[model samples]
Target: MPETPSALPPPSPSSSLPGLRFAFGTLTVLPVRVTRWDRPAARAGMLCAPLVGVVAGGAAGLLGAVLLLLGAGPLLAAVGAAAVPALLTRGLHLDGLADTADGLGSGKPADDALRIMKQSDIGPFGVLTLVLVLLAQVAALAEAYDGSWAQGVLAAVVSGASARLAMTLAARRGTPAARPEGLGAAVAQTVPVAGALALAALLTALAALAGGALLGTYGAVRAAAAVVVAVATAQSLLRRCVRRFGGVTGDVFGALAETAATAALVVLALG
Candidate 1:
């Protein structure tokens, strides 16, 4: 018999790079303790989110620029930017969207509907939800593209940051996880509202400084819209989760972030 291959070593922990660990720990894994803003660890993690947004947004923006440069048209650029983020996050939100759709579509009791959501297999309702959400996103992006690289980059960054902010807010509100334990629970309990607000304010100011009043206003509005949608959606989902599964889960939180982000972008484009 062939020998089993050795597993890769876990990532090293570094005090100097607490932000990376916080981001990775809160977003990607289930840790016993999520760093708190009052503590240095939570502050470090808070920084990680915006940094990730900037890097991811920049890359997506560059791809959009390339598509435009190649004469691919605004629609293509929109699609590419949207697709890049989805791929980067490995469709985490999309999966949540799908699950939520399936749960909601069943018309069954809350418990039964949630059980359906927990199933790994996608249902017909999930497929329809995915299609509609993607269509809405593509349409919004195509309309927003104005043949300007700066706008594209700003749009990407704002969308990403706003979405992450939504997630942070949801966690702060005590949305429970469906499973007994996970990163979502830890994040919800650990991240501070003040830090999130501060980050949003700083990012808004930076956008205004970099892009002028109109651009800054747009970013601010987008962020606000994202927060509203996130909060409302989280409340609705949390209630449903409580009725069914007795609490919220990491997946629902991811779904809330994606939905809010997409809605915020659409609203910004329309404005």
Candidate 2:
């Protein structure tokens, strides 16, 4: 017999707490204690991912602004901005990016590729990809900071939020998991496509508003474009990874986030 609606358990004391805890717990080295690991919590966490990015990126941007105030050059400030997210996440995303690169670059069979990604060591492809991606991020951030400290900060926040937005969309329903276990399996296909789209629209609007307030009309256009282009780039990678790996993995998510961040920064760097 099916359980009636009233037979369901009472809602948590704070309905949002579980999601918040899950987001911070998994995405960052935050102190939040995750009270749930089920699909509901994962759904809410993925939906809230952009906010997590905003906070992490906000910290990164603030650090860059602080360095600037201390008379550091734009390059140094940019480096600081790039490093904070890594520290906050315990470099998990970077490691994932490296592993994903190795896996995809090997051109081996799907099973072999998955095994490569599972290993702890980084390959030459991973090293090269990491170097190029990091260089691109730092150079773009340096250019933005040189333009203005506000622009630099905006770049960091926008890219951070957009990066996680990519991850959120990657978790939308119908997306498959490459493995039957691990983080990807736990969170994959947890987000509704409509929900993901709505979140994206909301974030894009906020970016436009904030950009206009900070950098004027041109800034608004660039900010919106950055989000759009970043999403497009991430989706491109998503399609390719699905073809190569047969589905999504935790490493693929990391690659998407990094790619989105780098794309956003590059767009913001444009004259």
Candidate 3:
């Protein structure tokens, strides 16, 4: 369930084009062509991941808002919002989450666990985890929508963006990949600590502004908290996956995204 790297065409000659291509190319089902697979591009892509998340999550939120405007019930709007990110990513992150869950739940040695993760079939743990995670996501969204459509949109965007921001932190220099091949290997430890921290600060500020614009000062605080909580939750999972699996993997990345998104939703749902 790792991100399938696009085959290298000629590298882009522009300064920033390759990274933008890499971010959208691998992180979404967007039509952009990725022309570079080098470390520099991977670094740029990792840094740009949150931007991709903003676009994807904003799209998802807009869809939900449109549904609500069309007289759809909160539950229906919530479902639409929940479905969009999965559809947008071709469920890539969900598949990764399932695989990571299977691996972590196996109670086997690291090698054995990695082997379990590599299997195509969904194990009981993976299935249960997926079901529960999706339920939590949907339920949280519904709650936000019930409060107000603006809250629902805010939750969706914040959760989505925060989810990818988690990866930026994961990719900070010094984080190791679990294996020698795959998406994790390609992007691991690609971001500088300063760069990650700066982007995180910017994201948190934007979250506050989004919340303030949508709700109020309280909303701004909560929105910022949601990002913080999401990142913290993802970081916990990343550390655990690294320890259990010997390092980060594509599946681990998926797990972190889902975890962060769900955590953000949960925090936003709190009254």
Query: Each candidate's TM vs. the true structure?
Result: 0.74, 0.95, 0.94
Per-residue lDDT of 47-166 in model 1, one digit per residue for the tens? Answer: 466565555556676788788889888889989988876776778778887887787778888678767877999999889878887887777666666637666766676666656655
Error of 1 at 48 (Å): 3.3
Please write out the lDDT profile of model 2 over residues 101-180, one tens digit for every residue: 99999999999999999999999999999999999999999998998889999999999999999999999877888998
Q: Residues 13-124, candidate 3, lDDT per residue (tens digit)?
A: 5636889899899889989999988777887888889998888888888888899999999999999999999998898899999999999899999999999998989999
Off by over 4 Å in 3: 1-14
Clashing pairs in 3: none
Q: Please give the range of 10 consecutive residues that has the lowest summed lDDT in model 2.
A: 1-10
Candidate 1, residue 24: how far the Cα is off, in Å:
4.7
All candidates in order of lDDT, best leading: 2, 3, 1
Among the numbered candidates, top lDDT falls to 2
Report the lDDT of model 3 for residue 138: 94
